[model samples]
Target: MGESSETSSAPETETFLHENQRSFDVSNDAVTHDNKKSGKPAGDSDDDLTPDDILLQLGGCGLFQILLALIIQSMKTVICWGIGGNSFFAYVPKWRCTDVDDVMNISSTVSPLTTMAINVTDTTNTTAYWNQQCQLPNGTHCSNFEFESSMHTLVSEFDLVCSQSWVTATITSVQMVGMMVGSFVVGHLADMFGRKKPFVLSMAIICLSTIICYFSVHWIMFATARFFFGIGASFFMSIYCILQGEHMLSKWRSTTISFPSWALELNLFSLVVFLLHDWEHVTLIMAFLAAIYLLTWFFIPESFRWLVARNKIKEARLVVNQMAKWNKRPVVNFERMVRSVEKSLSGDEDAKYSVIVLFRKRPLLRLTVPLMLSWLTLGVIGYGVGFGVKEFSGNFYLNLFLFALASIPFKLISIYLQVRIGRKFTSIIAYIVCLVGGLVVTLVQYIDTPYRGGLTTGFALMATAGVGAAWGPMQTMTVELYPTVARNTAFGFLSVLARLGAVIGPQFVYLEVLVPGLLYIMIALLSFISIMCIISLPETNHRMLVDRLVDDLDRERKQEKDHMDSH
Candidate 1:
């Protein structure tokens, strides 16, 4: 049956079901109820409702959903503190070689100097000197250095400058690798066990790892702590979106999924870092804030869709009843209603679905490949522009602030565009915007002007905004494309690719060292490829999510039939 079904369906096209099993079952169950009321032959059972049917009864967008949104939003924002802290904590303040005597006696107090002020012939004279050496080959040099900023950073504390400048960037790449591993592990755990346990455990990991970051006395120790922190943050972020999408109604999905919280965190975190320049203080503060989220253990609940998919009907019913109570709705024949959902879901109990299922079918593989490419572009451009924020011309704080600020409008515009145009077109347009932004930045690198710094920052801000714009639409597309059984795993697969992009992203700065303008040019190329990939995908504007993989293929067949009928 599966082989014949696959051969008949269009390999190039895939679709989400316009109506879900729960909604269809609700209508049939209503007919059964009416037949019973009229003293007619009532066929089958009147209690044939799914979990989503219970959700619809309790009001899809209600107090419970809103509460969960707030919880996810707040926690999502908090995790950014750990993910983004590297920018500030590893910030290399302006420094210069200190004075030394003829007998190798160092001065009690070092001179207040910038890289340009040092008149050393052998040392690199550039203001941004990653390759500058404190000691020349002649040995007539000072190894110790002094920084302009009073606050202690990784650079100042560990003297991670000159020969060690590359270490900071390496740590970020390592963290991205950790995030890749964490997403795969935590996503599988969420699918296998339940969303709540993994979600809460991830939060705890964030809190503890951040504290470890604070107490580290060496750079390697700090990097290790940061790696675990990255895992925790990625775990939390992946599950947060899944939980939000799984709970909210279909209509609100596009608008609800956005980057406002992420943008807001960057904006606020910049101010916090500026106020508290000390890295230790920043790490401690972030750890404390993350710990506060642990208190939300009682408030947050397991995903209803996850529970229903795993066949934990009793637990699903308890959540349903709580949701009903919070939304001020009364349930009738509650046990029967839940039992009907269980029976309907029982057919899939013997079947095991994982990320591998997405590749087992041609239609799903086609859809999955494009989404993976889109996310890879997102990670490359998003973190690529972000990690290089300090390299842009202008004050680091101002650049970070504006870069984050630019994201807010683009994200909002993406939501509006997805609603108006459709997911595929919106994504294509956003990628083109990113491509334009990248080209502008690349152009600035070759131009010579007094306002070059300002120009680079201005155009780079546009690139950041473009990446932000693509996020919301891409998330909506991912959620609407796959079935519940393999949804998080598919997302995890994409996340691993995205993190691979991120691992490559931090190296863009290093690439720039080898060839000027190489960073933005590469970003532009990826953005173009992403645009092409998006063009091949079908629009998923107002489709409902399917619970099983077979249902996804069935929807594709139905769509093909409808297209033929219309012709």
Candidate 2:
């Protein structure tokens, strides 16, 4: 009878939203049941429902959200696979003058066996052996460079080598510009409208862009198509990553966050290089992947957390109940479930966040600059290694395969460490490895040893592994560090902003002609800067995923305000 009386003494309630779970502590002040007939479970102001708690009650996050994250992440990553595709296609293959003597305007029979060698009489004026005299008594250099007929590439077809080579870099940079624009466009829409619409539209746009890219008759045409491709690709990751990650339970969140990389992209790059052997065909394969995502509507729904943040109370409650049912768990009262989420008094809950806020917000300003630069530098490290792979010893395909192979173990280690050591430490070690590994790759050039090929490839692989390992932690850090209200908006804004590095990454290959060591030097510097930035970010390891407008930072400030007022 004493226990019954204790239970009866508690504040009036119908049922706990989650089975076998206690509701948040409520005030003991007697409350009138004015709305009791209306069937709403009223609660004290402290009552807050968290998604983590809701999912825990559901017994599982359910298969639907898992499949949603997997399909979207895996499919969108195909676009990421293609980012390095430019390396193989933009590579300026070895060339020899077609009419060497006639082009030099020399009067003589062209010797079929003309010997050629490099002339570096002046280090600054060094020229290729054949280029020493385009017309070797009968052959001369011309504006047109004739590459070997067996190998095919965009540089070979468009003749973007020599003086006009900047066009190749222009191609990727313009695409980055497009991505930068698209991230904002799609990100705003996703935050305002819903996740599914923008995701589906972006996939469709990707398919259209791929098809148009295949039919390009001129470089400008290809560039225009690539710009649209960038738009589609940027939108895909910016919106989709946040959409998918938000749906995940925290345990699976790490895997979902990191799932975009590993060996998946490099493997695709190797396969495209070896089998497709044609840029046009590779674009078509990307089209097919985009088409597959159109089926996502049948399976995916708005994230429950997103809905709640948006105040779609009815929908959020419905999804949670459905999730519970799907997980073979009991249902909870919608009113009680939602009331358990804490409210924010700092910022207007309905006010929209923009990209500028990333820099303006005091908590975010410090993180924004360093993390964005890291994004840029990591891109250079990743794609720079890709373009320079040919400079390494061994067969081209073999070296590319080995680089891809090296990432698997490091990526696994990264996944394990991000949870144990935390995101900051994981990113710090990865960037440090990148710095050391990049220096090793460049050091191989100065060593002048026969083992240069093995050494260069090995260290290049190290940089590649470090880049791969950093991706998951960086992604998770991005998602978890920001509040849910601004998460997707921030992602969209940052995706494009950081991708500025990704845009320039492939272009580092252009430096191969000027000074090969310069590219590695640039990479090493970027890695060091990124490591410092990682050091500055708040460690987010094992923290409860923020699912509402209530920020711990804001709460602490409020508590300090209350204490001061007591004086």
TM-score for each predicted model, relative to the true structure: 0.85, 0.80
lDDT of 1 by residue, 1-567 (tens): 244224333322221232242132221222222344565422234645544555666776788888788778878766776665566666777776653332333333565353234534344445644334477545665577766555577888888887788998888888899899988777677777767887888778888988887788888998898799878877886777788888865656676787488889888888987788788887777777778888888988888887777777778778877888888877534676556544454355445567776777776887888888889888888877788887776677877788788889888888888877887888888888889988988888888877777877887788888888888888878877777777788877788888888888878877899888777898899999999898877766654466655534545545644543343
Off by over 4 Å in 1: 1-47, 99-133, 137-142, 332-343, 350-352, 551-554, 557-567
lDDT of 2: 0.66
Q: How displaced is residue 324 in candidate 2, in Å?
A: 3.4
Error of 2 at 146 (Å): 4.9
Taken over the whole model, the C-alpha lDDT of each candidate is 0.73, 0.66
Model 2: CA > 4 A from native: 1-48, 101-150, 260-262, 341-349, 548-567
Q: Evaluate residue 273 in candidate 1 and report its C-alpha lDDT on the 0 to 100 scale.
A: 76
Model 1 gets an lDDT of 0.73
Question: Residue 372's C-alpha lDDT in candidate 1?
Answer: 85
